[model samples]
Every structure is written in C-alpha cells, then in structure tokens.
Target: MTNFDPAALPAAAFEPISELGPLSRERIKTRLDARGYNYAIDSDGDIGGRWDDHIFYFLLLGKDSEYLQVRGRWSRTLPASSLGQLLVLANEWNAGRIWPKAYVRTEENETLGVYCEHSVDYEPGLTDAQLDQHLGCAISTSLAFFSSLDEQFPEAVAAAKEEIARLTAEQQ
Candidate 1:
C-alpha cells in the first residue's frame, strides 16, 4: 500500500455571495432574468427557458441545502418502442460524461422522453462568479446533449413532430 498525504490535496475555499442575500429560488430567477435570458416561472415556481431547440429548467432545492437542480428536456418524444434504444444511449452518455447524466421517462401520453439533469450544492455558499459559471455550464451542457440526441436519432425527432401535429389537430 502507498502512503497517503493529506497535505497533497489542495484546500477548497467557500466564498459566499456578499452582495446578494440568502440564495433562494426567487433570487436564482432574478439573477437569471438579469442575465437577459427569457424564462418563465411556472405554477410550481420553477424557472424554465428554451434555447436552441432544448427546453431547460432550474429548481432551487432549498436554502438549507443550497442545491440547484438543473434539467434539460428534448423537444421531441420518442415512441415507446424506442425505450430500449434510449436506455442504451443514456447509459453510454452516463458512462462517458460526468455532468448532466441522461435518463428516459414516459410522459402522460405514453411517449418516451429523454432528459438530462445535474445538481450543484454549495457547502457554505456560492460566490457570484461561481453562480455564473454553474449557470453557464448547466445551460450549455443541456443544449449540447439535446443536440447530440438529435444527431443520433433524427427519425425520432421527425416522428415526434408528426405526433405533435396530430395531437394539435385533435385538440382543435
């Protein structure tokens, strides 16, 4: 066995956002809005936005936990038959990528939806720079993963569009 040295590891510092008060869900929304990205606060108080064909959302876990939940949804839903394939793809992504792990879930209409989620928790708190970096990383990773899904299965996207049109016409 090799000898371990605790001093070899660099110490991390927790820098709180002095200019801002307690980081709440509302504060997260305000900061995001100030950055000029268009977003909507849903009935559940989660903030969501659409960018480059991907729908992304963020939910503040809680002030005590200081955790931010970020998720990205593919605009299209795949057929039920594609669940196995989707699982395979998600597993490949989870194995290769560290942030924004992929998952598949069934929607109310029985369509399979692919999603990616990442959570960041600040021990003491977060600095403004840290918040900004986290936000940027979350959004970009979501958009990139969505694009990767599209590139991997173009047919699923096209089928989803057709299904959307059919559903819309039925509603009308």
Candidate 2:
C-alpha cells in the first residue's frame, strides 16, 4: 500500500467544519431549515418531517444523548396477514444494505409497521460536516429502501397514501 501523509494532502480535499459539539435538536433543525424543508414539533418535543408520503424523525438517544438516530416509518401499516411476508422482506433488505437497518414491528392493534433506521454514536461529539453526512446518509438510504417498498406494496400503500394526503392538506 502507498503511504499517504495526512498533512501532505491538498487542503481542497477537505471541507471546513465548525467546532465539534454534542448533536442536539437545534443542530438538526438548523440543517433542516437550511434546506428550506417543512417540519413539525411533536407534543413530546420531538422533531420530525415528511417526505414522499413518509415520516422521519431526527432523534438523540443514549444515556448521555450521544447517539443520533434518524428513523423513518413507511406510509402504510400492513394487515396482520402480511407479517410473515414483511419479515422476509426486512431480512432481505438488511442482508443487502449497509445503511438504514430495516425491520418490522407489530403495532398494538396487530398491524405491522415497517421501519428504517440509521443510528450512529458520537460519544466525543461531531462537527457540522459529519452531522450533515449522517443526515444525508440517513435520508437517502432510507428513501431508497422506502422506494423499494412502494414498488412492492403498491396495493397496500395506495389507501394510506390517500389518507396521508388528506391529513397533509388538512394541516395546510
């Protein structure tokens, strides 16, 4: 392997970043606002936004709140009958992808919910650039998986899509 010197690298090879700090909701909001994306604050003080008929939440977890979890839920909840099929799909997705760990969960009413999550720990902290990379990876990868689900579950999602559309309009 060729030995590479970090200091010898061109400055242009790197992007400037702000001082590292613990990831916070404010930082998340800053990035979202910068993109001019519409978002909402839940009654629980969680931050979330919708894209392509799906909802995603930017959450800080861990004992010290040092982990960032960007999570998304599919637009539709599958009937109980689909649980077995969904489990297979989730397993296949996890086996094939590196980002966005896909999984299925049973809701209280026995329906199945498909979720995609990309979580990373930053115990030391993170810079603005690193945070942006996390956000981008979380969103793009999750969307890729969601798009596959859309194709696979068109009949299931069609009704949910209409409901979400109606709710979105009502909010407006």
Candidate 3:
C-alpha cells in the first residue's frame, strides 16, 4: 500500500463526492449493485439511503454534521469486499466520520475492520491540514481492511479502487 499523505494531496484533487449531487449517488449504487450488493433505499429516509446484502449495510450520508447516526444490522458473514468498497466510496463522498459503532466481523465474530460511530468534528477554526488528517485516517483504515481480505479477492478491491479513481477524476 502507498503511504497516502492527505497533506501532499492537492485540495483540488481530493474533491468530495457529495458535491457531485445525485449523479454520485447513482454511480456509487450502480457499482455496489454490480458487485452483487442488494441495494435498498431506507424507508425512513433518516440517514440518506443504504446498500446492503447478507453481509454489510452501507449507510450513505447527505450532509456534514457532528451528530450523525445510523441504525442497521451486522451480517453474520464478514463483508470485507463490501466494506472495502464502502471505504473507497465514503472517501469519495468526503464522509468526515462514518457511523454504526460496530459491523465488520469474522465468521467467529472477530473484528477485521475499523467499525465505529463517532462525529466528524467540524469547528470554526478547522483547517485544510485537519481535514487532510481526517481523510488520511479514514483512507488508511480502509486500506488496512482491504489488505486483510484474501488475495484471491483482487477483483473486488481493484474495482473499488478503480471506481474511486474514476469518481475522483470526474471531480477535477
């Protein structure tokens, strides 16, 4: 894995996917569904929508706030592939902090990914440096999860990376 330093990344380069509007949503949903995710729009419409299957539930967010919340179920099977894709997509979406305190788990209930629900603190004096740090943390955590998956699952990881690159490129 490359040492991704958000500080080294150009501000223009790390464009947030949320700014892309509905098109971004469509693209993300399509990619997940193509990977065999059973996509669903949350009926309550509380935390945007969700794309889920027997494995993982990706809670999409619409705005930046401190008190974000998500309600869902964790799959008995670990959705490493889906989680990897979610991380890439969340990074693209500029999700400051992802929710649902716990999710990723091995068949034996061993946690393999960083699963936590916390605020992406935004304050008056927030700087680009701070934002970059947050982004770097999220990206690196996702990379770690991606690395944990078996090497044979290259297609899913590759596709997730490709989609992230494509979406990031479109923002430029």
- In terms of TM-score, which candidate is strongest? 2
Candidates ranked by TM-score = 2, 1, 3
Error of 3 at 137 (Å): 1.7
Summarize candidate 2's per-residue lDDT along 7-98 as a digit string, tens digits: 89889776545577878899989988887878999998889988887899999899988999999998788889998888888899999888
What TM-score goes with each of the models? 0.79, 0.83, 0.27
Model 2 poorest 10 in a row by lDDT = 12-21
Tens-place lDDT digits, model 3, residues 1-172: 9898989978988765433222123443555455454546566532222222112233444353332222333222335546665455435434543432333434344423434332343422234444344333433443333344424356555665677689899999
| Stretches > 4 Å off in candidate 2 | 1-18, 164-172
Report, for all candidates in order, the number of backbone clashes.
0, 0, 0
Candidate models: Cα lDDT each: 0.79, 0.87, 0.41
Model 3 misplaced stretches (Cα beyond 4 Å): 1-102, 105-119, 151-172
Q: Tens digits of per-residue lDDT for model 1 on 33-64?
A: 76888888899878888887678888777648
Q: Candidate 2 clashing pairs?
A: none
